[model samples]
Target: MLIFFKERLALLSVPKTGSTAYFKSLRDRADIVVSGPPDLKHAPVRRFDRFFQNIFLKMYDTELEVMAVVREPLDWLGSWYRYRSRPELLGHEKATHDLSFDAFVQGYLRTPRPAFADVGSQSEFFRTRSNGRGATHVFRYDNQQAILDFLQDRLDTEINLTRENVSPKRPMDIAPQTERRFRKIHAAEFDLYDRAR
Candidate 1:
């Protein structure tokens, strides 16, 4: 996460939506940077509200508006599948080396998801709190230029970002039935992504 004190904005690092590169590019320009420990780096809306918001409110006398990128739900899952398919993870139980995309989705559908398919949900990540804190701005993962443009205009500087932490290239296709099931199971995710600018 990168917090721009002057702008009163917090750029949330949503997993699989490619926030790492943004974090890297904005680190120096940000007032506060949180990039260590995967759990903290990928802090979701709830976590941010509990921790960062209170601190910012006390110190800055303003709540930083949160922003995040969300990818299409299926594409997001495919990234996770491809990521886990990397050679280094071949023997690991969390790897998707031996599973088809359909199987991965099936695992996600399970009450107790198999490790490989327990990719986090984007909708839940940016879900609004009862206290009215939530992502004030959201961009689609595919809409990279728009995100960069937003950052550039907000920070008053050109933003440069190289792709970082890309999932491996693969024939990542899902079965139609699996896609339908996934969409049904995670309808809110699709809804949220559709709402993203």
Candidate 2:
């Protein structure tokens, strides 16, 4: 997560959404950057509301507008699948080296997901708190220019990004029936991505 205090903006690091690259690009300019201990680094909307919002309001008299990027549901899952397939994770319980994309996604749909498919839901991550606070600005992963434009204009500074933490390139094909089931069961993810600018 990157916090630009002066701009009253907090960028939530949604997993597999190129947030690492944004952290790399903006860390120097951000007043506070949480880039370690994955849990904190990937702090979601509710976590921010619970842990940091009050501090900002009391100390700085600022109500930070949260921003985040969300990727298409299937593409986001594919990234996770490919990432865990890396050779270094071959012996890890969470590795996807032995699973096909379809199997991985099917596992993800299980009530108690298998370790390899246990990635949390993006919709859940950005869900609004009881107070109706959640990400105020959202960008689609495919729309890099729009994200950049918004950041540059908001921060009043030049922004440059370099790809970081990219997952391996692989052809990820899910059976049509499985894809249908996934979309039906995880419709919230699609809805959230569609609403992103």
Candidate 3:
């Protein structure tokens, strides 16, 4: 997460949405840059609302507007599948090295997902709390220009983001039935991505 206190903006990191590159580009510009301890680095909307938002509001007499990038649900899952299939994760319980993309996605739809397919829902990660609080500016992971334009204007600086954490290339084809089920169970993810900038 990157916080620009003067701008009253908070950039929440939504996993697999190319946040790392943004962090790298904006770290020097941001007043507070969190890039350690995955949990904190990717702190969800609820956690931000509970832990940081209220405090910032109290101190500054205003709350920061949160920004985040959400990717298409299936593409997001495919990224996870490919990420875990890397050689280093071979034989690990949570690795997807031995599973096809279809099988991985099918397992992800389970109530208690198998360890290998336990990637969390992006929509859930960005969900608004009961107080109706959530990211104010959302950008689609596929639309880098929108995010870049918004940041450049808001921060008054040119941003040249470098690609970081690219998953290994692989053919990831989801079965028709599995894709249907994924869309059914995770429709909110699609809805959120569609609403992004």
Report the number of the highest-TM-score candidate. Answer: 2
**Alpha carbon lDDT of residue 186, candidate 1?**
91
Task: State how far residue 120 of model 1 sits from its true place (Å).
Answer: 1.7
What RMSD does each model have against the real structure?
A: 1.1, 0.9, 1.0
lDDT of each: 0.88, 0.92, 0.90
- TM per candidate comes to 0.96, 0.97, 0.97
| Residue 38 CA displacement from its true place in model 3, Å | 1.3
Q: Largest lDDT belongs to which candidate?
A: 2
RMSD in angstroms, candidate 3? 1.0
Candidate 1's residue-wise lDDT over 65-177, tens digit each? Answer: 99999999888888899999988998898999888888888998998888888887888898766885788899999998899999999989888898788788877677898
Ranking by lDDT: 2, 3, 1
lDDT of 3 by residue, 19-58 (tens): 9999999999999888879989999999988888998878
Off by over 4 Å in 2: none
